[model samples]
Target: MMTEKQLTDALRRRDEAAFRELILRFQPITARVIFKITGDKEETPDLVQEVFVSIWEQVKNFREEASLSTWIYQLSTNKARNHLKWKKLRTGFRLSWQSEQAQPPAGMNHSLNMALEMFERKDDENAITMALQQLPHNQRTAFVLSKSEGLSNPEIAAIMKLSVSSVESLNFRARQNLVKILLPYYNNKKS
Candidate 1:
């Protein structure tokens, strides 16, 4: 496997194979960051592709101060944030995915999104997913990066351009707000 430096040097040389290698190597983390931020599985694949394209265009600007993964996460997060902003302006970030939708592609589990946590019931999992969407974007991003993506607070802070303390605060508020919003469903599940 080529080291990150070798891959980056290849990328800087405009080597197509190196770009493909970069995509293959980083797509998992890239998808996680994009999907978690956007919270829309249907759009994630396309957004991820767009992220790679964006990366290709901006490879020359990537200073090696951070790991390649960190750079990719930063790019993916910004893309996802921009996509959400455009989506909100277009439709106010409506929750009604079923209202006017196209058929999902084959082999895609439209029922479960990429976060991929197991729940006893699909409904409960989906309910939590919906509640997550209603959170302030900072809190949701922090929570997803910390819990679902298993990134350290410092990593999340770096990706989010916030202080580590701010990331901690966001995580705290995210948990509190999720419980506040979903406590009824959680109680119902218990009983």
Candidate 2:
């Protein structure tokens, strides 16, 4: 039941138990940050592991000026950015992985495929994800942290290394752009 500061101190001293606690406490947030950025569930587990590994090596260098969670977030976001860069260079396109959904029955006709796609499960979430993918990386991250992860502007600013006003601006633009992107989809559904 150690506090985050005590746990960080133990981790700085290279305690295995502290590292384990760190994993248990922070892995989910780290995973979510990377996964939202990359949109790849298959890639997230490995990326989370890599984030912890980097943190393990760098814990001794932590200056404690920021909260431990902030540091972890900064590390996770940086790693995710690097991963996206490397992936884009290798693949020449961003891979937006869809959520796991029920497979269509085999041997469907083209019309049936179109009809089924029109009524697909998770359509709302998927459409929102598509819009999110369309946003620039900073805007997307700022939006997700603000809206999805329920983080405050100051926390997001720390994670993004931006001023709080900049974070606010990013969130503002993200919302406006998302409304523009998703308005047609909702309108189409009503037709």
Candidate 3:
């Protein structure tokens, strides 16, 4: 088996086999991370492909300071965030046009499908998702890494380029905010 450096060197040299090996090895993990961040299965496949393409383009500059997996995680995270931001911008534009025309947007049905309605009818999962979406980007990233991805605070800190204590603080605040948002619904469900 080739070391990560060897694989990276091969990729830098544009070795097809090495690229295939890298993709086969990392694609599932990349797809999972993208899905967790965006919660969109349809988009995850293409996004994962884009991330690998980025990795291929940037592999030459990869300093071996961090583990390859960490580098890949960082790349995927940035790509996913950028994609989400673009999506939000596009949605905003569509919303504006719909308001002008007095018509529902083309993708409103999909948006409704992706909404937090499950929180109203079911468990805390969708509520967590909704609360996560409400959080600032860094806070949400920290929270998701800590909770949904089952990463330690230190690992999240490394991936997010923040201190461990900052990751911990973000996680704490995220939990507080989530609880505050969900408590009423939770109590009503029990009652």
Candidate 4:
């Protein structure tokens, strides 16, 4: 297998095989990031395709200031963020398109698990998505990257071009806001 530098060098040279290898290697990760941000599995494949196209076109500008994966994370997040903006503009609300049966992440805290469980009833997976959408973009990004994608705060900070503390703050705020938004639902479900 080619090293990351070798793959990037080949891509910068406009190598078709290297591009194919790039898609094969990065597509799954790119898809996961996009899906976590957008919550739309149907849109994920197309978004992943767009990310690869961007990497192909932008490889020459890659300065190697960060690892290739970090750079790709930056790209995927930017793409997903723009997608969310366009979707909101079109729909007049932040629409979430989650799977039929959304499973809570293994690393989730007890409160978050309880919050998600409250949405497990028929066709209510959207409650989780709606609560996530209530967060600000930066907070939502930090939360999804940390909680859903299992990315480290430093990794999220790098991708977001923020300090580690900022990522932590965003995540903290996100969790607090999610609880505030979903607490009533959890209470109502129990009653």
Candidate 5:
């Protein structure tokens, strides 16, 4: 198997096999990153493809100062953010497209699914989603990166181009905001 550098070199030379190999190598990671940011499984697949297309166009300009994974992560982050912004501008509200189809088996609890269906009927999920959308961009990104993608602070920092300390600070604030917003629901559920 070729190293990342060799693969990148081949891609730069416009080798189709190398491009396919690169897509195979990075698609899952890119998908995860985009999905975490958007919380929209239906949208992630197309967005992941867009990220790779952007990478193909921009690979010649890559400076190699950071690992290729890091570069791709950063690119994925930017694309996801742009997608969110574009969606907001186009729709006049941020539309979430999270489909049950992509949820982890562990997260697909029957009771929770029933509860979510009830909440949907009551439009409560929209409230929670709106509250999450109210969070600051960096805090939202940090929270999603940590919780949804299971990325560590160091990894999020690398992706966001922030210091580790900054990532931690963002996550702390994000959690605080989430707790405040979700407290009523949590209390009701407990009761």
Candidate 6:
């Protein structure tokens, strides 16, 4: 197996094999992160491709101050955020958490019950996704990386270009916001 440094060096040199290895290694996590962040299945595949293309184009400029995975995570989060901004602009709709009734994509499984850990049912996943979408971008990113990806606060901070304390704060605020956004939905369901 190639070391990360070897892979990064190869990628910087534009080696096709290194690029393919990078995709094979990172694609699943990248897709999951993008899906969780954007809450859009249809756009995810295209967005993932865009991320790899970006990595290819930008590898030369990578300073290697952080791990390659951390750098990739940062790039993916930025891409997802930009996608949301463009989508909101194109549709002239606010990307608010107060969404109309939405359905979780088909085939949601126990594994996807990452952060909430309580969403055994599809409806619960839908509610979580909607509530997650409602958070501010930094909060949402921090929450997803911490809870869903199980990354550490320091790692998240590196990816987000924020302090560890900031990541913790974002996560705390994200949890608070998710509860506020989801409470009414669960109450209505119980009624």
User: lDDT for each of the candidates?
Assistant: 0.75, 0.77, 0.72, 0.78, 0.74, 0.81
In TM-score terms, candidate 3 sits at 0.77
Top model number, lDDT = 6
| Clash totals, every prediction | 0, 0, 0, 0, 0, 0
Query: How well is each residue in 68-143 modelled by candidate 6, as lDDT tens digits?
Result: 9999998899999999999988998656432222332221222123323434345546777866766667888899
**Candidate 1 overall Cα lDDT vs. reference?**
0.75
Write one digit per residue (lDDT tens) for candidate 3, span 18-86. 999999999988887777777667999999999999998888888877878888989888887887778
Model 5 misplacement above 4 A: 94-134
- Clashing pairs in model 4, backbone N/Cα/C closer than 3 A: none
Show where candidate 2 strays beyond 4 Å. Answer: 94-125
lDDT-better candidate, 2 vs 4: 4
| lDDT string, candidate 4, 77-186, tens digits | 89998898898889886343232132323323443555455466544577767577555567778888898789899989999999999899888877876777688777
Worst 10 residues of 6 by lDDT: 103-112
Output the better candidate (1/3) by lDDT. 1
Candidate 3 lDDT trough over 10 residues, lowest sum: 93-102
Which residue ranges in model 6 land beyond 4 Å of their true spot?
A: 96-125
In terms of lDDT, model 3 sits at 0.72
Using TM-score as the measure, the top candidate is 6
The local lDDT score (0 to 100) that residue 14 gets in candidate 5 is 87
Candidate 5 TM-score, true structure as reference:
0.76
Q: Mind sharing the TM-score for model 4?
A: 0.80
Ten contiguous residues minimizing lDDT sum, candidate 4? 99-108
Which lDDT tens digits does candidate 1 get at residues 1-191? 89999998899999999999998999998898788777789999999999999888888998998887878888888888788878878997442232113233321233233222333445545766666765666777788888888999999989888999989988997787666656655666688
TM-score of each: 0.80, 0.82, 0.77, 0.80, 0.76, 0.84
